[model samples]
Target: MPDYYISQISHTDKTVIQGVTALLNAEGIRLDANLDYTCGMYDDEMNIIATGSCFGNTLRCLAVSSEHQGEGLMNQIISHLIEVQFERGNTHLFLYTKCSSAKFFGDLGFYEIARIDEQIVFMENRRTGFKNYLKKLEESSALQLQTLTKDTSANTATLQSDNALPDTSTADRKIAALVMNANPFTLGHQYLVEKAARENDLLHLFIVSEDASLVPFKVRKQLVMEGTAHLDNICYHDSGPYIISNATFPSYFQKDENAVIESHAMLDLTVFTEIAQTLGINRRYVGEEPTSLVTGIYNNIMSEKLPENGIECIIVPRKTDGKKAISASTVRQAIKDNDVDTLKKLVPESTLRYFESKEAKEVIERIRNSGNVIHY
Candidate 1:
């Protein structure tokens, strides 16, 4: 019954930002660092009672004052954020909310995608968004299988040999997957893909499609495909919004140090279970990342969680170029320093060629202008 109004909270307005941060803190929430837009609801007395934020298509760091509980202020905030998102052309919206608060958002038309026990819940506006994603994966897998079968038959017929084709039977076939950012598609990536392709009947390669890295997603994907073109067992899949990349993961969503890391890994792996099932994936391969704390934590979480879902998680040791282990971050640093020799040692020829092309001129400039390129 109390009068209330919502307004956009400018990041530059330190006074109002402090008020919003105080309210969120009182509610045991932290201000998310990755937000592009934020808004706060004010009562008649100009007190900040509720707040919400938008990062890309995600609604994050939402909170309401304890005194305003059940006053329908959050509904107003959500509506305001939705309108803002619509204006921004982000129709398919996503959000992260506490598990206990999920039902309230559900009533507002957000469907749950995945959760990490009682810590956090990942939701989206569309009811069938995740289902449709899985269906697309299944369809893509089937199409690729058909093409591979045809190619195998043609090769066998041309050779006129009884043993030209390998066993394509489902019983003995090994289907595995690898999800990679492939920011530059280094030789290390090629090494992992080569090993996986050699050992598996089919490899579902999911390229992180989020454009958050120094190298854009389009270039990353092109380099990945071009670098692995020799491998015949690969079925490439754009991660879309389903697969969470480092860029898309909201690291600042949770206040607890370990919970932040665990929540991200758990939510991602939970969604991946369904994807793995759809593609008949029994194993996942990841390159060893011994330096980055976030990635180390994620790999550990994957090792524990994937096995519970009957999927094996394999961490392949990083491939070395005689001196140091090859990494995208290292290659990025090389690009920044214009170290052509280091670049040659780290990335595949296809990836190296891409960076040297006229098409990569802007991207090279972008990388060179960046302050830091190393992941750690």
Candidate 2:
């Protein structure tokens, strides 16, 4: 065995943490900004030659020096981290590593979850890591459905609770899916849905059901359902915290541009593709974003990575409305600026009626008081 000892390093251990970070940084690794726990392999000289960390069951920032390669130190470091997670009642573990080193980890029983390119691959242990997550989500969804059904009579005017997708499968039809957050749905949103509906035999429109957006989830879903009612073959589904949310891809919301979009994108797309396979969706469609940097990066990631898994990615250009591109952000800006003419042009008739309703009066006033807006 090498003359080394592994030890836990607290976040406050600045000096020792710096030593480990130096090793990882020199190896060109992206550091996790937050860590629940960390472990380091120190040489007899007390230098951190290897280091690894765990962030919410995901093992991250594992690096072994080139000089120590082939010495079985990587396995040692990983075993320590996995045990750390195991002790915390987390049997399933996930990790991100380069594609080249994947085989090394694979030998240790970590299977590939998703890969962004030759440079990056996300892997998880085979012990119900992903399967458990799906089960938990389904249970939560079922409970919510029961609650909604029970309260429908009480809040008929306030709550519109009938958004459920058909699970009926048809192997002969070419099923396509479009995941979106039509926050107070706009004409551009309608155009994309219409295009996908026109091209595919069946289109699954998954409105991002996460309530993290500025617009409430109830309002957003209602707008989308009302606006797209014209499409007969389109089915409405909920995103269920699987796409572009803290549960999957949190970096999509953070302002830090230095964060790696690759890992977040891969992790989210991995879960999405699983659901896609279950639904027999072979095509994924997205609107070409010209303004939002974060959204654009996500679109590019899907375009590149989805194809590897046999899903065709279609990037549709935004539909223009004579003066400007018809977008949800444009609609929001119009609401903020009290530009009725622009809002009327940008949004669908359903969205317009919603804006006029007494139920929407508070949201409109809030938007008016809000500052200059940029959707990312």
Candidate 3:
């Protein structure tokens, strides 16, 4: 065994960065565009042997030279990246690796959350991370079921007075789910939720909790809750780094035009199967995507893959305001332009009033300062 050293690869240092890129390319891996830090493992001759990078809490673009296989260099690279994530206050970590490399990562204490077409495996540091997430989801489902049963009992008593015995058992309930980013909770989002809520026995609404969007997660969740307060059969859940998050779907946040949309969507829906099983979700609702190539591709993949997993993927036509389909992008553009009338037509009153209030001043400024508000 020869002595090897690991060190951070400064983004400004093109010479060392090129070496890292060449190494990753040689390993048939593209250097991810969203990395905040990259590090390389060098041999005694200062030649790059292994490399790994980090973006948020995710470890990505990892590779070990073919010639250096079984040299334990990858372990060193992973350990270094874990230390970096810990220093950045990211306790729970995640990574995406090829199916061939997943076993290696699993041996290093990572657990698989899902795999996409048997090509990419999404893994995390904690063993019970995904299990605990499923447990929490099941608990939420039980609580919602208990509430429904109680309501049904009261309704049953009323029906008994009328001499009509109706089936109020939850066994026949049609559970559905909808996943949304809802950057600012536009009317289109509300329309989708409303329709799903109307048709389903219980609708589990999972909001993307990542803060990578122009609108922060807290504000997005708050607006969604306020906008849909009229809906009674909704179990609101924060998608915590599990569903369509940076860990599961980095392309959603990075906005990489060249991203493999199908691959990302498959991984997300693969994990979504577990969530569906936990909550008895038999269907998923998504607004039809006519614009936004990335989301369009994602929806296409989802429509194809989810059905294969026993979950019906419903693509509801986008709600139109007598013109074009109302989109979050349009709402964001209206906000950027301060078009009050367009805002009134695009979002619910709660969302509109929030943007008008002082609390939304910061978020509005953030959106306005963002040069590009439309995602096409």
Q: By lDDT, who's the top model here? A: 1
lDDT of 1 by residue, 1-376 (tens): 9878889989999999999889988988888768899999988889999999999999988899998898888889999999999999999999888889999999999999998888888899999999999998899887987776677775656323321224656465678899999888999999999998877778999999888889999999999999998777789999999898766677555767577777888989999998988877899998887877888999999999899999989999999999878888889988998999989999888998898899999999999999988875
Stretch of 10 with least lDDT, candidate 3: 159-168
**RMSD versus native structure for model 2:** 8.3
For every model shown, what is its TM-score relative to the native structure? 0.95, 0.59, 0.90
Model 1 off-target regions past 4 Å? Answer: 157-168
The candidate that wins on TM-score is: 1
Clashing pairs in 3: none
What is the Å distance of residue 12 in model 3 from its true position? 3.3
The RMSD of every model to the true structure, in order and in angstroms, is 2.3, 8.3, 3.6
Residue-level error in angstroms, candidate 1, position 88: 1.0
The lowest-lDDT stretch of 10 consecutive residues in candidate 1 is 158-167
Q: Positional deviation of 111 in candidate 3, in angstroms? A: 1.2
Clashes of each: 0, 0, 0
lDDT of each: 0.87, 0.75, 0.83
